[model samples]
Target: MEFKWSVPLIILVLVNCDLYSTIGGSTLKNCYLCNTYEPSEPESRSYSSESSELVGILVLKIVHLTLNPNQPSQATAAKIRSCCGGPVSDHFQSDQFEKMFSNRSSLEVEDHEIENKGFLDYQSFITASAFYQPYGFGTTYINQDFFGTKEVAAFLAHVATKISCGNKVVTREQLSRDLCYNKEMNSDLSYCDEHYKNTYPCAPGVAYYDRGALPIYWNYNYGEAGKDLKVDLLNHPEYIEQNATLAFQVAIWRWMTPIKEHQPSAHEVFIGTWTPTKSDNLAKRVSGFGATMNVLYGDLICGHGDNESMKNIISHYLYYLDLMGIDREEAGPHEVLSCAKQVAFNPSISSSP
Candidate 1:
C-alpha cells in the first residue's frame, strides 16, 4: 500500500513556515494542500502575493520530497543487498505456508472457530514481506552458510503465536488451531494512555484493542504505526483487521521497528545486527531469539523464570522452524531461546511501544 508523508515532517514544514512568516512577511492562509483545495473560501485565498508565492514554493518542495526521497549511494545499496540475502518467496513456498496453518485454514477441523477463515493467506504475507525485504526483514545473512530463513521462521512464529487461538497445551491438535482470530476477543478496553494525550490522543469512540497478525495495542502504538504505515490507524484501527496484507505489513513493521530509541528491534536482536551493551549483558539480554523476546515483551515475558507465556511463544517458534524444514537445534541452546533471566528493556510502568 502507498503511504503518505509522515505527519511530523509536514508539521515541521508548517512550523518553519509559520516562524518565517511571523518574522518578516504575511502568514499563509489556512488551506488544504494535500486534500481538497478550497479555491472559493476567502480565507484560503486571502494571503498576500509574496506569502502566496512562498506557500506555493513550500508546497512544491513538500510534494517533491514526498515523491522523490533521497536514494542511497550505489555502494551503500550494494552493501545492503549483500547483507539482506535473497527474496523470502524464493526460500519459502506457498504450499509450505498453507501446510504450516492447515488446521486453521481447513474447514474440516472439528472445533475450529476462526473469526476470519481463509483471510490470512500466503500471498498476503508475501506481499507484506516484500515491502520490508529491502530493509532485511527476512533476508539478513548471519554468515556465508546461514541466510535469513531462520529469521523468517522466527518472525512468523511470533505472528502465529499472537494471532493463533490455540491453547497453551503443546499438542498437534492444539497447534492446528493456529491463526484462529484476527483480533483480540471480547476486549472492551480502548487502551488509550493518558500520557500521550497531546501526542497521540484517543479518537472519540475508537478502540485501540489488540489486532493484526502480531496484535498491536494502545493509542500510542496505533498512532505510531499509523504514522509509519500511513494508514490513519488512530481513527480507523479496524483497517488492520479488514486488510490481510496490511495486517501482515503492520506485524512485520512491528518486528522491524524498535519500540524505543537506542533499543534493539526484534529483527536486530534476532539476526545479531545489534550488539549488546554492558547494561544488556548485565541484564542477561544476549542477541538471539531470547533477546528478540526481551526486545518485544521486556519483563512481561522475560526475567520471570520460565513463564508459560514465554514458553508458549518459544514453542511456536520451534514448531514453525520444524514446519519450515529448519532444525530446531539451529535456534541455539535453551539460554539463547529462552529469556527467563533478561531484564525488561522498557518496563510496563513506562509507555510501551
Candidate 2:
C-alpha cells in the first residue's frame, strides 16, 4: 500500500527548483521531500547543468508548505503553477470514483489501469457527489467526523484506495459530461423512473440528499436509513458522547473490512468511553442501528430492548456479529470482549432507553 509518488517529473522538477530559489541562490538546492536547503551542485549527477543550477542557485528562501505522502501536493507545485488559472493537477483515480456507483469490486485489472492515470480534481469529484468542494470528505474533517456513515466512508475509502493503488476512478471527459440523467436512452421507463426522472447530477444517476450527493446502494438493506439513524442519534447533545463513540466503531468495522480484515483488540481500548450519562438515555433506541445493519447484510437481524439491562446490549451487538460469521477471534478476543464489557457497564446505548 505504498503510494509511489506519481507526480510527473516535469512538475516535480519545476516546483522543486523554484520553491526555494531565494536564499539558496548560487550554492544550494531545496528538496521538497526534505524541506531543507542543500548545496546546489545538483543532488544527483543526472541533472543538466541548468537543472542543477536551478536546484542550487535559487533553492533557498522559497516559502514552503508542509509536504507529506498521502497529502495533496503543494498548491504552488510546478505543475499547478504552470497550469495557473487553468485546471490544477489532480493525483487521484477517476475511474474508481465512477465505479463506486456500481457494486463491482475495484480489484479488476481494468480498474487498476484506470486509477494509475493520475492527476485528479477532487473538488469536481466532490461536486459530482452533490457536495461543494469540501475541505475533505465526510463532514469535511480529517478524522472520524469525515466518515460517519457507511456510504460516505465507503466513498472516501474507495477514493483513497484507488489513489494509493495508482488507478483512475473517473476521467476528465466524464467530468465534463452531464453526470445525471441519460437523455439518449429514454425509450423505456417505470413510474418511479419517470416520476423522479431528473438526472442525478454529480454522482451520475443519483441526486443529492441534504447538501451531499446520494450514495449508491452497496451492501443493500439500510443504505440511507442506516446513515440517518446514526445522524439522528448523535445530534442530541446529551447522547453525543456515547453515540459518537459507537458510531466510530461501526464505521471502522464497515470501512476497514477488506483491508484490515478485522480490527485488533487495541481498537476497543482506544475507542471505549467512560460510562454514559443520564442524558445519554435520550438517544435513539439501538433498534434503528441494528435494523440498519441487518438490512445492509441481509442475513442478520437485530433486536433492541428498551431500558434493557446492560448485559443484553453487550450480547446484542455480539449476537449480530456472530450471525454475520464474524467472531471475537477475528477482531481479537481481547478487543471484542473489551467492547462487550463497556457495553455491559454503559447505561445508555442500550436496547431500552
Candidate 3:
C-alpha cells in the first residue's frame, strides 16, 4: 500500500523577459529538493521500541503527510531524504557538549525530587542526537554546512536557559556561572486543558507541566508529542527527566516543528526559510534568531523592552557560541538577537507581565 503525505506546494513561475529590458528583479529558480538517498544499515543503531515507533511518525511530521506505522516505506524514506538536501555535517562534538553542560552535575538535586534522573551526560546526548538524524532535523537549516553549528548552539542555549537552576542569582557575574540549572522546578497547577480532553485527555495521575530541555506543557502538547514521538508521554510525563536521549529528542522535535498551523518552524525562522509578509514586516518579524524566540515564547518574552527572560536565553546562545569557538560577533545585530521590538507571531492577551 502506498502512503500519501502532504508536502508544501512548490511554486514554479516561468516568465519570458525581453533581452534588452531590466525592469523588475529576475525570478531566480530557488532549488529546494535534493537527490534522494537510502539509510544504510539503519539496524546498526539500537533504538528502543518507543524510539523506533518515532521514525514513522517523525517521517509523517516532516513530510506533512500520512503513512502506515507498521510497514517500512522506501518511497517515504526517499521523499524525506530529498527534503534533507545533502549529507548532514558532523558539526557537533562530544567535548563541546560537555563544556556546554559542565555545570549540570553540580545542580541541586533536591532530596524530595522524585523525578531527578541525574545530570544529562555528554555521551548520552551525543548518542541521542545521532539517533534523531533520520528525523530531518539534523540539517534543518536549508542544507547549509556550518549553519548547522549555529542552529545547534542556538538550540543548546535555549535548552540551558529553560532548565537552568540559576534562577536565584541576580548578578550577571554570578548568573553566568550559574549555568548548571537542569530539571524543571515548577510545582504549580497541572498544565492540562479540559477542552482538549477528547483528543488529549489528562492522564489519570499525570501533570502535563513544563519539563525537559524545551518543555512541552499541557495535555494537548503532550498528547501531540507522544503521538509524533511514539511515546506515551501523557501517562509517562516523568520519562523526560528519566531518559536523557528521549529528553534531547523531544527538545529537537520541538525546535524543528511548528507550534501552530500556517506558520514556519523555529528552525525555519532561524535558517531564513520563512519570509515575512507585509503585516509581519510591519510587526518587525524579520527572519532571524529573535523571530525564532517570538515564535516559541510569543508575548511572554517578546515585545517587552529589555525583558530579563528573553535576554537570559539570548545570553545563553551568545555564550554557547563563544564556547563553541564561533565568534559571538557573528550572531548579528541587536534587532535580530533581541525580540524587544518585534510583535509576537502568536501573541497572547496581556503582553505585560
Best by TM-score: 1
lDDT by candidate, in order shown? 0.68, 0.25, 0.59
Q: Candidate 2: list runs displaced more than 4 Å.
A: 1-92, 98-125, 134-139, 142-151, 155-353
lDDT of candidate 2 at residue 63, scale 0 to 100: 15
| lDDT per residue (tens digit) for residues 1-353 in model 2 | 22222224323643542322331122212222212222222223233332212222112211122122222366534332111110111222344344432322223324333321222223333322211111121222212121112224233332233222232324422212211211112223211223223331122333222111111212121122233223322122112122222222223223222111222111111222112245323332122222222222222112232322222223333332333334434323432322211222223232210
Candidate 1 wrongly placed segments (more than 4 Å): 1-82, 108-113, 348-353
Best by lDDT: 1
Q: For candidate 3, give the lDDT.
A: 0.59
Model 1 Cα displacement at 62 (Å)?
28
Question: Which ten residues in a row are the worst by lDDT in model 2?
Answer: 80-89
Q: Candidate 1, clashing residue pairs?
A: 84-139
**How much does candidate 2 score in TM-score?**
0.20
**Per-residue C-alpha lDDT of model 1 across residues 113-136, encoded as one tens digit per residue:** 457866777767876665455456
User: For each candidate, what TM-score against the reference?
Assistant: 0.75, 0.20, 0.70
Separately for all candidates shown, the number of backbone clashes (residues 3 or more apart, or on different chains) is 1, 38, 4
What TM-score, to 2 decimals, does candidate 1 have?
0.75
Give lDDT: candidate 1, residue 181. 77
